[model samples]
Target: MNTTNLIATIALLACATGVFSHEKSPHHAPKAAPMKEQKEWGIAGDVKDVRRTIAIRMTDDMRFTPSAITVHEGETVRLRAQNKGKVLHEIVIGTQAELAQHAEMMKKFPAMEHDEPYMAHVRAGGQGDVVWHFNRPGSFDFACLIPGHYQAGMTGTITVLPRKP
Candidate 1:
Protein backbone atom coordinates (compact mmCIF):
# COMPACT_ATOMS: atom_id res chain seq x y z
CA MET A 1 0.00 0.00 0.00
CA ASN A 2 1.01 3.60 -0.62
CA THR A 3 2.08 5.76 2.37
CA THR A 4 -1.26 7.61 2.53
CA ASN A 5 -3.21 4.37 2.14
CA LEU A 6 -1.25 2.71 4.91
CA ILE A 7 -1.98 5.64 7.27
CA ALA A 8 -5.68 5.58 6.36
CA THR A 9 -5.86 1.84 6.97
CA ILE A 10 -4.29 2.27 10.41
CA ALA A 11 -6.75 5.05 11.28
CA LEU A 12 -9.70 2.90 10.25
CA LEU A 13 -8.44 0.02 12.35
CA ALA A 14 -8.06 2.28 15.38
CA CYS A 15 -11.60 3.62 14.96
CA ALA A 16 -12.94 0.09 14.65
CA THR A 17 -11.28 -0.91 17.92
CA GLY A 18 -12.79 2.11 19.63
CA VAL A 19 -16.23 1.27 18.33
CA PHE A 20 -16.13 -2.28 19.63
CA SER A 21 -14.52 -1.52 23.00
CA HIS A 22 -15.29 -3.67 26.01
CA GLU A 23 -17.93 -2.59 28.51
CA LYS A 24 -15.51 -2.51 31.43
CA SER A 25 -13.14 -0.30 29.52
CA PRO A 26 -13.32 3.42 30.23
CA HIS A 27 -14.77 4.98 27.11
CA HIS A 28 -16.91 7.80 28.43
CA ALA A 29 -15.94 11.12 26.98
CA PRO A 30 -14.98 14.04 29.19
CA LYS A 31 -14.17 11.74 32.06
CA ALA A 32 -14.20 12.83 35.68
CA ALA A 33 -11.11 13.33 37.80
CA PRO A 34 -9.20 10.30 39.07
CA MET A 35 -11.07 8.56 41.89
CA LYS A 36 -7.91 8.01 43.89
CA GLU A 37 -8.17 11.43 45.48
CA GLN A 38 -9.95 11.04 48.80
CA LYS A 39 -13.18 12.99 49.06
CA GLU A 40 -14.98 13.99 52.21
CA TRP A 41 -17.16 10.93 51.81
CA GLY A 42 -14.16 8.62 52.25
CA ILE A 43 -12.08 6.37 50.02
CA ALA A 44 -12.66 2.96 48.52
CA GLY A 45 -11.96 -0.03 50.72
CA ASP A 46 -10.61 -3.45 49.95
CA VAL A 47 -13.06 -6.31 49.98
CA LYS A 48 -10.94 -8.19 52.46
CA ASP A 49 -11.06 -5.18 54.76
CA VAL A 50 -14.83 -4.94 54.73
CA ARG A 51 -16.24 -5.83 58.14
CA ARG A 52 -19.96 -5.41 57.53
CA THR A 53 -22.18 -5.94 54.51
CA ILE A 54 -25.28 -3.81 53.94
CA ALA A 55 -27.78 -5.29 51.55
CA ILE A 56 -29.68 -2.70 49.50
CA ARG A 57 -32.37 -3.22 46.96
CA MET A 58 -33.05 -0.96 43.99
CA THR A 59 -36.58 -0.98 42.70
CA ASP A 60 -38.31 0.58 39.72
CA ASP A 61 -40.36 2.71 42.07
CA MET A 62 -37.34 4.95 42.39
CA ARG A 63 -36.45 3.92 45.85
CA PHE A 64 -33.67 2.18 47.73
CA THR A 65 -34.56 -0.22 50.48
CA PRO A 66 -33.10 0.94 53.78
CA SER A 67 -32.23 4.28 52.29
CA ALA A 68 -30.60 5.49 55.45
CA ILE A 69 -27.47 3.80 56.75
CA THR A 70 -25.10 4.49 59.60
CA VAL A 71 -21.50 3.39 60.10
CA HIS A 72 -18.78 4.33 62.50
CA GLU A 73 -15.75 6.31 61.45
CA GLY A 74 -12.76 4.15 60.51
CA GLU A 75 -15.01 1.27 59.58
CA THR A 76 -15.05 -0.43 56.21
CA VAL A 77 -18.42 -1.66 55.02
CA ARG A 78 -19.53 -3.54 51.94
CA LEU A 79 -22.49 -2.03 50.12
CA ARG A 80 -24.25 -4.79 48.24
CA ALA A 81 -26.87 -3.56 45.79
CA GLN A 82 -29.36 -5.90 44.24
CA ASN A 83 -31.40 -4.51 41.38
CA LYS A 84 -34.89 -5.87 41.60
CA GLY A 85 -36.21 -3.50 38.97
CA LYS A 86 -36.35 -4.08 35.25
CA VAL A 87 -33.96 -1.25 34.53
CA LEU A 88 -30.38 -0.38 35.23
CA HIS A 89 -29.56 1.23 38.58
CA GLU A 90 -26.36 2.54 40.08
CA ILE A 91 -25.16 3.76 43.45
CA VAL A 92 -22.59 6.51 43.67
CA ILE A 93 -21.28 7.64 47.04
CA GLY A 94 -20.37 11.27 47.23
CA THR A 95 -21.07 14.48 49.07
CA GLN A 96 -24.51 15.99 48.67
CA ALA A 97 -23.19 18.74 46.41
CA GLU A 98 -21.23 16.23 44.36
CA LEU A 99 -24.24 13.97 43.92
CA ALA A 100 -26.38 16.91 42.86
CA GLN A 101 -23.86 18.06 40.33
CA HIS A 102 -23.36 14.55 38.98
CA ALA A 103 -27.09 14.02 38.70
CA GLU A 104 -27.39 17.17 36.63
CA MET A 105 -24.60 15.98 34.40
CA MET A 106 -26.24 12.61 33.99
CA LYS A 107 -29.42 14.29 32.86
CA LYS A 108 -27.46 15.91 30.08
CA PHE A 109 -25.49 12.78 29.20
CA PRO A 110 -27.66 9.85 30.02
CA ALA A 111 -25.25 7.36 28.44
CA MET A 112 -22.19 8.58 30.26
CA GLU A 113 -20.25 5.56 31.50
CA HIS A 114 -18.57 5.64 34.88
CA ASP A 115 -16.58 2.96 36.70
CA GLU A 116 -15.26 4.39 39.91
CA PRO A 117 -14.48 2.45 43.03
CA TYR A 118 -17.16 4.38 44.89
CA MET A 119 -19.83 3.58 42.31
CA ALA A 120 -21.54 0.40 41.19
CA HIS A 121 -23.78 -0.01 38.14
CA VAL A 122 -26.12 -2.89 38.75
CA ARG A 123 -28.15 -4.37 35.99
CA ALA A 124 -31.73 -5.48 36.35
CA GLY A 125 -31.94 -8.76 38.26
CA GLY A 126 -28.24 -8.47 38.86
CA GLN A 127 -26.16 -7.51 41.86
CA GLY A 128 -23.14 -5.30 42.44
CA ASP A 129 -21.06 -4.19 45.36
CA VAL A 130 -18.96 -1.29 46.58
CA VAL A 131 -16.63 -1.60 49.54
CA TRP A 132 -16.01 1.73 51.18
CA HIS A 133 -14.07 2.89 54.23
CA PHE A 134 -15.69 5.47 56.45
CA ASN A 135 -12.82 7.56 57.72
CA ARG A 136 -14.75 10.80 57.90
CA PRO A 137 -17.54 11.79 60.25
CA GLY A 138 -20.57 13.25 58.49
CA SER A 139 -23.41 12.43 56.19
CA PHE A 140 -22.79 11.53 52.55
CA ASP A 141 -25.07 10.91 49.63
CA PHE A 142 -25.61 7.96 47.32
CA ALA A 143 -27.87 8.16 44.31
CA CYS A 144 -28.77 6.57 41.02
CA LEU A 145 -27.84 9.25 38.54
CA ILE A 146 -29.53 7.62 35.59
CA PRO A 147 -31.35 10.59 34.07
CA GLY A 148 -34.79 10.46 35.79
CA HIS A 149 -33.80 8.12 38.60
CA TYR A 150 -32.40 10.76 40.90
CA GLN A 151 -35.27 13.13 40.17
CA ALA A 152 -37.66 10.33 41.00
CA GLY A 153 -36.10 10.22 44.51
CA MET A 154 -33.72 7.30 44.04
CA THR A 155 -31.25 8.47 46.60
CA GLY A 156 -29.90 7.54 50.02
CA THR A 157 -27.83 8.89 52.87
CA ILE A 158 -24.84 7.40 54.66
CA THR A 159 -24.04 8.77 58.08
CA VAL A 160 -20.51 8.14 59.38
CA LEU A 161 -20.54 8.81 63.05
CA PRO A 162 -17.36 10.14 64.55
CA ARG A 163 -15.14 7.73 66.40
CA LYS A 164 -15.23 8.03 70.15
CA PRO A 165 -12.01 9.28 71.62
Candidate 2:
Protein backbone atom coordinates (compact mmCIF):
# COMPACT_ATOMS: atom_id res chain seq x y z
CA MET A 1 0.00 0.00 0.00
CA ASN A 2 1.04 3.61 -0.65
CA THR A 3 2.09 5.86 2.31
CA THR A 4 -1.20 7.84 2.25
CA ASN A 5 -3.33 4.69 2.07
CA LEU A 6 -1.33 3.12 4.93
CA ILE A 7 -1.89 6.17 7.08
CA ALA A 8 -5.65 6.19 6.33
CA THR A 9 -5.94 2.48 7.16
CA ILE A 10 -4.14 2.97 10.50
CA ALA A 11 -6.53 5.82 11.48
CA LEU A 12 -9.57 3.69 10.68
CA LEU A 13 -8.19 0.78 12.70
CA ALA A 14 -7.50 3.07 15.65
CA CYS A 15 -11.12 4.36 15.60
CA ALA A 16 -12.54 0.79 15.54
CA THR A 17 -10.25 -0.27 18.41
CA GLY A 18 -11.34 2.70 20.53
CA VAL A 19 -15.00 1.90 20.09
CA PHE A 20 -14.52 -1.78 20.98
CA SER A 21 -12.33 -0.90 23.96
CA HIS A 22 -15.08 1.30 25.45
CA GLU A 23 -17.59 -1.53 25.16
CA LYS A 24 -15.22 -3.96 26.95
CA SER A 25 -14.38 -1.55 29.80
CA PRO A 26 -15.40 -2.56 33.36
CA HIS A 27 -16.12 1.04 34.40
CA HIS A 28 -19.73 0.84 33.20
CA ALA A 29 -21.66 -0.68 36.06
CA PRO A 30 -24.82 -2.69 35.67
CA LYS A 31 -28.03 -0.88 36.42
CA ALA A 32 -29.47 -1.37 39.90
CA ALA A 33 -32.80 -3.09 40.45
CA PRO A 34 -35.86 -0.83 40.63
CA MET A 35 -36.90 0.08 44.14
CA LYS A 36 -40.07 -1.28 45.60
CA GLU A 37 -42.89 1.22 45.80
CA GLN A 38 -43.98 2.35 49.25
CA LYS A 39 -47.37 1.20 50.45
CA GLU A 40 -50.14 3.75 50.99
CA TRP A 41 -51.91 3.87 54.35
CA GLY A 42 -55.57 2.82 54.57
CA ILE A 43 -58.09 1.53 57.08
CA ALA A 44 -57.75 -2.02 58.32
CA GLY A 45 -59.01 -4.05 61.24
CA ASP A 46 -57.77 -7.28 62.71
CA VAL A 47 -59.93 -10.16 63.93
CA LYS A 48 -58.14 -13.36 64.96
CA ASP A 49 -55.24 -12.73 62.59
CA VAL A 50 -57.60 -11.90 59.72
CA ARG A 51 -57.60 -8.27 58.63
CA ARG A 52 -60.66 -6.49 57.23
CA THR A 53 -60.01 -3.41 55.14
CA ILE A 54 -62.48 -0.53 55.15
CA ALA A 55 -62.52 2.66 53.14
CA ILE A 56 -63.59 5.95 54.69
CA ARG A 57 -64.22 8.63 52.10
CA MET A 58 -64.36 12.29 53.07
CA THR A 59 -66.07 14.93 51.01
CA ASP A 60 -66.52 18.69 50.85
CA ASP A 61 -69.96 17.97 52.20
CA MET A 62 -68.13 17.38 55.52
CA ARG A 63 -69.28 13.91 56.41
CA PHE A 64 -67.91 10.45 56.98
CA THR A 65 -69.69 7.47 55.58
CA PRO A 66 -70.98 4.86 58.05
CA SER A 67 -70.50 7.44 60.73
CA ALA A 68 -70.69 4.90 63.52
CA ILE A 69 -68.33 2.08 64.43
CA THR A 70 -68.43 -0.59 67.14
CA VAL A 71 -65.45 -2.60 68.29
CA HIS A 72 -64.45 -4.82 71.17
CA GLU A 73 -62.31 -3.29 73.85
CA GLY A 74 -58.54 -3.89 73.47
CA GLU A 75 -58.92 -4.52 69.78
CA THR A 76 -56.56 -3.07 67.22
CA VAL A 77 -58.11 -0.93 64.54
CA ARG A 78 -56.61 0.53 61.42
CA LEU A 79 -58.49 3.44 59.90
CA ARG A 80 -57.77 4.61 56.40
CA ALA A 81 -59.16 8.00 55.58
CA GLN A 82 -59.33 9.49 52.11
CA ASN A 83 -60.27 13.04 51.30
CA LYS A 84 -62.41 13.03 48.21
CA GLY A 85 -63.40 16.65 48.55
CA LYS A 86 -62.04 20.09 47.83
CA VAL A 87 -61.09 20.79 51.44
CA LEU A 88 -58.69 19.26 53.92
CA HIS A 89 -59.90 16.84 56.58
CA GLU A 90 -58.64 14.94 59.61
CA ILE A 91 -59.57 11.96 61.74
CA VAL A 92 -58.75 12.55 65.37
CA ILE A 93 -59.49 10.17 68.22
CA GLY A 94 -59.43 11.55 71.74
CA THR A 95 -61.47 12.46 74.75
CA GLN A 96 -63.40 15.71 74.67
CA ALA A 97 -60.56 17.43 76.52
CA GLU A 98 -57.83 15.95 74.35
CA LEU A 99 -59.64 17.01 71.23
CA ALA A 100 -60.00 20.50 72.57
CA GLN A 101 -56.31 20.70 73.40
CA HIS A 102 -55.42 19.45 69.92
CA ALA A 103 -57.60 22.08 68.29
CA GLU A 104 -56.06 24.84 70.36
CA MET A 105 -52.54 23.70 69.62
CA MET A 106 -53.30 23.38 65.93
CA LYS A 107 -54.50 26.96 65.93
CA LYS A 108 -51.32 28.30 67.49
CA PHE A 109 -48.77 25.96 65.92
CA PRO A 110 -50.58 25.33 62.65
CA ALA A 111 -48.04 22.76 61.51
CA MET A 112 -47.18 22.10 65.14
CA GLU A 113 -45.73 18.73 65.94
CA HIS A 114 -48.77 16.67 66.83
CA ASP A 115 -48.31 14.86 70.12
CA GLU A 116 -51.68 13.15 70.00
CA PRO A 117 -51.31 9.40 69.61
CA TYR A 118 -54.36 8.87 67.41
CA MET A 119 -54.93 11.60 64.89
CA ALA A 120 -54.36 11.90 61.16
CA HIS A 121 -54.78 14.82 58.79
CA VAL A 122 -55.59 14.18 55.18
CA ARG A 123 -55.37 16.98 52.70
CA ALA A 124 -57.50 17.34 49.58
CA GLY A 125 -56.98 14.48 47.13
CA GLY A 126 -54.82 12.79 49.75
CA GLN A 127 -55.20 9.85 52.11
CA GLY A 128 -53.79 8.68 55.47
CA ASP A 129 -54.17 6.01 58.11
CA VAL A 130 -54.39 5.74 61.89
CA VAL A 131 -53.84 2.63 63.99
CA TRP A 132 -55.56 2.78 67.34
CA HIS A 133 -55.79 0.37 70.23
CA PHE A 134 -58.89 0.92 72.32
CA ASN A 135 -58.03 -0.16 75.85
CA ARG A 136 -61.03 1.20 77.61
CA PRO A 137 -64.72 0.51 77.31
CA GLY A 138 -66.29 3.83 76.56
CA SER A 139 -67.67 6.08 73.88
CA PHE A 140 -64.95 7.75 71.83
CA ASP A 141 -65.42 10.62 69.46
CA PHE A 142 -63.68 11.06 66.11
CA ALA A 143 -63.83 14.44 64.48
CA CYS A 144 -62.11 16.68 62.02
CA LEU A 145 -60.44 19.71 63.62
CA ILE A 146 -60.19 21.62 60.34
CA PRO A 147 -61.51 24.98 61.46
CA GLY A 148 -65.26 24.60 60.85
CA HIS A 149 -65.33 20.97 59.87
CA TYR A 150 -66.41 19.76 63.27
CA GLN A 151 -69.16 22.37 63.44
CA ALA A 152 -70.17 21.38 59.93
CA GLY A 153 -70.85 17.86 61.23
CA MET A 154 -67.58 16.17 60.38
CA THR A 155 -67.67 13.97 63.44
CA GLY A 156 -68.42 10.39 64.37
CA THR A 157 -68.47 8.01 67.32
CA ILE A 158 -66.67 4.81 68.17
CA THR A 159 -68.17 2.58 70.84
CA VAL A 160 -65.84 0.15 72.50
CA LEU A 161 -67.50 -2.85 74.09
CA PRO A 162 -66.37 -4.97 77.03
CA ARG A 163 -64.28 -7.98 76.17
CA LYS A 164 -66.18 -11.23 75.95
CA PRO A 165 -65.13 -14.00 78.32
Candidate 3:
Protein backbone atom coordinates (compact mmCIF):
# COMPACT_ATOMS: atom_id res chain seq x y z
CA MET A 1 0.00 0.00 0.00
CA ASN A 2 1.05 3.62 -0.47
CA THR A 3 2.41 5.61 2.51
CA THR A 4 -0.80 7.66 2.80
CA ASN A 5 -3.00 4.52 2.68
CA LEU A 6 -0.83 2.78 5.24
CA ILE A 7 -1.16 5.75 7.64
CA ALA A 8 -4.93 5.88 7.09
CA THR A 9 -5.24 2.14 7.80
CA ILE A 10 -3.15 2.54 10.98
CA ALA A 11 -5.35 5.43 12.16
CA LEU A 12 -8.55 3.41 11.58
CA LEU A 13 -7.13 0.45 13.52
CA ALA A 14 -6.16 2.77 16.43
CA CYS A 15 -9.67 4.21 16.57
CA ALA A 16 -11.23 0.71 16.59
CA THR A 17 -8.91 -0.38 19.41
CA GLY A 18 -9.76 2.69 21.47
CA VAL A 19 -13.48 2.03 21.11
CA PHE A 20 -13.13 -1.63 22.16
CA SER A 21 -10.83 -0.73 25.05
CA HIS A 22 -13.66 1.12 26.78
CA GLU A 23 -15.60 -2.15 27.24
CA LYS A 24 -12.70 -3.69 29.20
CA SER A 25 -12.37 -0.71 31.60
CA PRO A 26 -13.45 -1.14 35.21
CA HIS A 27 -15.35 2.13 35.17
CA HIS A 28 -17.69 0.63 32.58
CA ALA A 29 -18.08 -2.62 34.55
CA PRO A 30 -21.61 -3.97 34.92
CA LYS A 31 -23.46 -3.15 38.12
CA ALA A 32 -23.06 -5.65 40.94
CA ALA A 33 -26.80 -6.26 41.10
CA PRO A 34 -29.99 -4.72 39.79
CA MET A 35 -31.45 -2.14 42.10
CA LYS A 36 -34.46 -3.28 44.09
CA GLU A 37 -37.63 -1.41 43.32
CA GLN A 38 -38.88 0.99 45.93
CA LYS A 39 -42.27 0.30 47.39
CA GLU A 40 -44.85 3.13 47.57
CA TRP A 41 -47.50 3.15 50.28
CA GLY A 42 -50.65 5.17 50.81
CA ILE A 43 -54.12 5.30 52.33
CA ALA A 44 -56.49 2.37 51.91
CA GLY A 45 -60.10 3.51 51.73
CA ASP A 46 -63.11 5.45 53.02
CA VAL A 47 -65.41 3.97 55.60
CA LYS A 48 -69.04 4.74 56.38
CA ASP A 49 -70.98 3.94 59.50
CA VAL A 50 -74.66 3.13 59.71
CA ARG A 51 -74.04 1.92 63.23
CA ARG A 52 -70.84 3.42 64.65
CA THR A 53 -67.49 1.97 63.67
CA ILE A 54 -65.82 1.94 60.26
CA ALA A 55 -62.50 0.31 59.48
CA ILE A 56 -60.00 1.39 56.82
CA ARG A 57 -56.64 0.01 55.89
CA MET A 58 -53.79 1.82 54.16
CA THR A 59 -51.76 -0.30 51.81
CA ASP A 60 -48.22 -0.04 50.50
CA ASP A 61 -49.13 0.90 46.96
CA MET A 62 -49.82 4.64 47.21
CA ARG A 63 -53.56 4.33 46.69
CA PHE A 64 -56.87 4.14 48.48
CA THR A 65 -58.60 0.81 48.00
CA PRO A 66 -62.28 1.69 48.27
CA SER A 67 -61.82 5.16 46.72
CA ALA A 68 -65.45 5.99 47.58
CA ILE A 69 -67.68 5.88 50.63
CA THR A 70 -71.34 6.57 51.30
CA VAL A 71 -73.05 7.64 54.48
CA HIS A 72 -76.25 9.22 55.68
CA GLU A 73 -76.41 12.72 57.08
CA GLY A 74 -76.71 13.18 60.86
CA GLU A 75 -74.74 10.02 61.46
CA THR A 76 -71.58 9.69 63.46
CA VAL A 77 -68.70 7.93 61.76
CA ARG A 78 -65.79 6.37 63.53
CA LEU A 79 -63.04 6.08 60.99
CA ARG A 80 -60.10 3.86 61.79
CA ALA A 81 -57.12 4.39 59.51
CA GLN A 82 -54.29 1.92 59.76
CA ASN A 83 -51.06 2.53 57.92
CA LYS A 84 -49.80 -0.83 56.80
CA GLY A 85 -46.80 0.63 55.01
CA LYS A 86 -43.29 1.82 55.54
CA VAL A 87 -44.01 5.54 55.23
CA LEU A 88 -45.99 8.20 57.05
CA HIS A 89 -49.59 8.80 56.00
CA GLU A 90 -52.52 11.03 56.98
CA ILE A 91 -56.27 11.10 56.81
CA VAL A 92 -57.87 14.48 56.23
CA ILE A 93 -61.54 15.19 55.67
CA GLY A 94 -62.50 18.42 53.91
CA THR A 95 -63.55 20.05 50.68
CA GLN A 96 -61.14 20.22 47.79
CA ALA A 97 -60.19 23.81 48.52
CA GLU A 98 -60.01 23.19 52.24
CA LEU A 99 -57.78 20.24 51.71
CA ALA A 100 -55.61 22.30 49.36
CA GLN A 101 -55.32 25.03 51.97
CA HIS A 102 -54.59 22.49 54.65
CA ALA A 103 -51.94 20.94 52.42
CA GLU A 104 -50.33 24.35 52.02
CA MET A 105 -50.48 24.90 55.73
CA MET A 106 -49.04 21.48 56.31
CA LYS A 107 -46.11 22.42 54.12
CA LYS A 108 -45.50 25.40 56.41
CA PHE A 109 -46.12 23.36 59.57
CA PRO A 110 -45.27 19.72 59.45
CA ALA A 111 -46.40 19.13 62.99
CA MET A 112 -49.53 21.23 62.77
CA GLU A 113 -52.51 19.92 64.71
CA HIS A 114 -55.47 18.92 62.55
CA ASP A 115 -58.51 19.38 64.74
CA GLU A 116 -60.96 20.63 62.21
CA PRO A 117 -63.78 18.18 61.42
CA TYR A 118 -61.77 15.02 61.89
CA MET A 119 -58.21 14.31 60.81
CA ALA A 120 -55.19 12.30 61.79
CA HIS A 121 -51.59 11.97 60.63
CA VAL A 122 -50.13 8.62 61.39
CA ARG A 123 -46.53 7.57 61.21
CA ALA A 124 -45.22 4.44 59.59
CA GLY A 125 -46.52 1.19 61.11
CA GLY A 126 -48.95 3.33 63.15
CA GLN A 127 -52.68 3.83 63.26
CA GLY A 128 -55.06 6.76 63.73
CA ASP A 129 -58.75 7.20 64.39
CA VAL A 130 -61.17 10.03 63.73
CA VAL A 131 -64.74 10.47 64.95
CA TRP A 132 -66.68 12.83 62.74
CA HIS A 133 -70.33 13.75 62.63
CA PHE A 134 -71.81 14.47 59.25
CA ASN A 135 -74.65 16.87 59.90
CA ARG A 136 -75.03 18.06 56.31
CA PRO A 137 -75.31 16.15 53.09
CA GLY A 138 -72.53 16.85 50.66
CA SER A 139 -69.54 15.38 48.95
CA PHE A 140 -66.26 15.43 50.82
CA ASP A 141 -62.80 14.20 50.04
CA PHE A 142 -60.70 12.19 52.44
CA ALA A 143 -57.04 12.49 51.66
CA CYS A 144 -53.49 12.39 52.88
CA LEU A 145 -51.67 15.73 52.67
CA ILE A 146 -48.19 14.39 53.17
CA PRO A 147 -46.26 16.19 50.44
CA GLY A 148 -46.88 14.24 47.21
CA HIS A 149 -49.10 11.61 48.79
CA TYR A 150 -52.30 13.32 47.79
CA GLN A 151 -51.29 13.65 44.19
CA ALA A 152 -50.35 9.99 44.15
CA GLY A 153 -54.01 8.94 44.32
CA MET A 154 -54.04 8.62 48.07
CA THR A 155 -57.55 9.95 48.42
CA GLY A 156 -61.13 8.82 48.80
CA THR A 157 -64.57 10.34 48.36
CA ILE A 158 -67.06 10.69 51.19
CA THR A 159 -70.64 10.98 49.99
CA VAL A 160 -72.97 12.08 52.71
CA LEU A 161 -76.44 11.54 51.31
CA PRO A 162 -79.45 13.34 52.79
CA ARG A 163 -81.69 11.39 55.05
CA LYS A 164 -85.01 10.40 53.52
CA PRO A 165 -88.19 11.81 55.05
Q: Pick the candidate with the highest TM-score.
A: 1
The whole-model lDDT of each prediction reads 0.87, 0.68, 0.70
> Which regions of candidate 1 fall more than 4 Å away from where they truly are?
1-35
Tens digit per residue, CA lDDT, model 2, 37-88: 2212112333443344446788889899767888776577777888999877
Is candidate 1 or 2 superior in lDDT?
1
- Arranged by lDDT with the best first, the candidates are 1, 3, 2
What TM-score does each of the candidates earn? Answer: 0.79, 0.63, 0.64
lDDT tens digits by residue: candidate 1, 31-147:
565556587889888789988999999999999999999999999999999999999999999987888877876775577667788999999999999989989999898999999
Q: Compose the digit string of candidate 3's lDDT tens values, residues 43-150.
A: 222345335767777766877656788878777777778888898888887788777866765564566444433677777889888767677787888889887777
TM for candidate 2 is: 0.63
Q: What would you estimate as the lDDT of candidate 2?
A: 0.68
Runs of candidate 3 exceeding 4 Å displacement: 1-50, 115-117
